[model samples]
Target: MSERVIAPKSRGFLFLDSHPTGCRRLVDEMWQAVPEPVPAGGEGPVALIIGSSAGYGLAATIAGLARVGIRGIGVCFEKAPARRTGTAGWYRTAATARLARQHGRDMVFLNGDAFSDTMKEQVAGLLAERFGGRLDFLIYSVAAPRRTDPDTGHVHASVLKPIGSPCTTKTLVFDDDGAPEVKEVTTPPAEGDDVEQTVAVMGGTDWERWITYLDDRSLLAEGFATVALSYIGSPLTAGIYRQGTIGAAKSHLEATARALDERLGKALGGRALTSVNAAAVTQSSTAIPGIARYVGLLRGVLGDAMVSPTGQLVELWDQLTGDGPLVLDEEGRIRLDTWELDPAVQDAVAERWSVATSDTVPELADLDWFGDEVRRLYGFSVPGVDYSAAVDTEVAWPTRIN
Candidate 1:
């Protein structure tokens, strides 16, 4: 491996390369932010985290390791550095595994499409052989544009559009000055099988399959728990989110959780539910049409009250493993977005949303902070990291499950 200075490359919100040093530093910070772990009885807990390379999945993995002292197996699809630098998630996972080792915890990563049957089989086998043939928790946080069905061999792609009429909303776009500008974008309605396809890719079909496969193989432990991460934004962005194609898929995901909860409860006294997490600057979130503007307002209004992905997961881990009973909404889902949806918060954001313009965006919303947050997702613009220095682009995973 050769060390080279890698500048941050981006077009709009998409990142092309990642900095290893920055990624590792960010992961290290997340690990340190987790509260000191309580002693684990016997061999401790084990978790299987799907889509564990970045975003909420990565945060959950860190909480499991640092907060709960749990050994974990993570599944993610990320590109390695070859002609260009590896994806941010690749370096993040590598860094997470390294931290797990430094703390005497076991973390195994598998790099591949988690939607496929092969990956499931591999993880199941690994659990049976190395993890005492039992899993305490399973976290589903996969975010992808398309998925190839292992059973049907059909490729389904998810679209982020409203279900009925076109949705015109105020969004944020970067201008020539490299600053966020308020813009109105109209997303057309879903046509053809767009809704079906989105549901196929983002829905609970695969989640149910994973649980069934593991249960059939006798790999689920007593009192097992599984959670699939979801998001339901405020009514302002509902047309393009909660009431959109993605929302249709998420509805299916929630329904699947209910069914799985029943099945698991009857079988092994286990539990399954959906965790509606707070909106944050994630690689997948930046692509949503109205998210940038909403998040900007959110950041400005909420300020220190808004929780980061790692912070939300840390609370979730406490709720899950603590002696206190897990809190649930009327819908039986974990509501981590309560702060974002608070009446006071929404009222404050809506007031700013109506008056937000390109000129006033900076004042009304924290566009500058939002922009930096976007860059930080790709391992750039991070504090305490010298972007000017040459660093190795290639990073290695500590233990990669074949």
Candidate 2:
């Protein structure tokens, strides 16, 4: 096998990896941090997670395995290692499987397009053969740039624009030299079928389809629970986020949760819910317009209470499988972002937002911290990892994938 060579970090170029050592170290921290397990009780041991490679999906998977010992079947779309660049998620998934095996737990991974029908069937078949055709939990956390429907073969592209009217905000961009650059961006409202396309791509249509397919095949256990991640940001971002095209998709997602809640009960004696998570820096969030500035401001104001992906999942697991009744809003969805939307927190953020500008952002927000978090996501800022060391990109991934 060929070994991967490391290149020095260059200004304006994307940093892709922090070497396998650093990647493994980060994975170890997550797994070790999982809270001590309580009795499983009525909760089933098996879970199927879509988009389980990075961000919230990876956090939930780690928590499930470490905290509750849930058997994991993860499906993600990622690039395989070659001669030059390797994906960070490939390392993360490989590490997860290795850890699970060492702990004597089952962890299966399938690397393919999550939106593909063939992928669904492949996973469903594996579940039947390995897990006896019943899954206790299913989590959908897919974030992608485009989607192609399996049945119709139609492609839908999603946009991030405000609805009803154009809106202007301060958007952050990274310069070629890896410096932060701010620009006043005015995004036009969704035109034509922009709203519909965005909804089709990011909404719950795929999630609903997955459930329908799984239930039809008797793949879900009785009392099974399904959850999809959503976000309703603070008032400052309502125009571009909550009330925008993306928000339209989220609204559809919540509606699907309601419909699935009823359908699951009738069809398989199960439940479905949408979890409103906190606004944090993720691969997806940073791509949105003006999100970096908002997150930077939020970090400065909220301090350490800004929840992490790992923390979010730990709390979510407690609610899902704990002894207490699941805390939910009147709409039957979980609100894990109680702190992000706290009245006092919002008031503070609003006050800062009113006075925020490119010139003032550095003073008012933790922009450096926000940048560090983003770099860490791409395996760039990990401690003790030598950026100048040669990386073996051809390091073997698991071959016994289900």
- Which candidate ranks first by lDDT, i.e. highest? 1
Candidate 1 lDDT for residue 76: 95
Candidate 2 displacement at residue 112 in angstroms: 0.6
* lDDT per residue (tens digit) for residues 255-306 in model 1: 9999999999999999999999988989888889889999999999988888
In order of appearance, the predictions have TM-scores of: 0.97, 0.93
Model 1: what TM-score? 0.97
Clashes of each: 0, 2
For candidate 2, the per-residue lDDT at 355 reads 79
What C-alpha lDDT does candidate 2 achieve relative to the native structure?
A: 0.82
RMSD of 2: 2.5
- Flag clash pairs in model 2: 4-392, 12-176
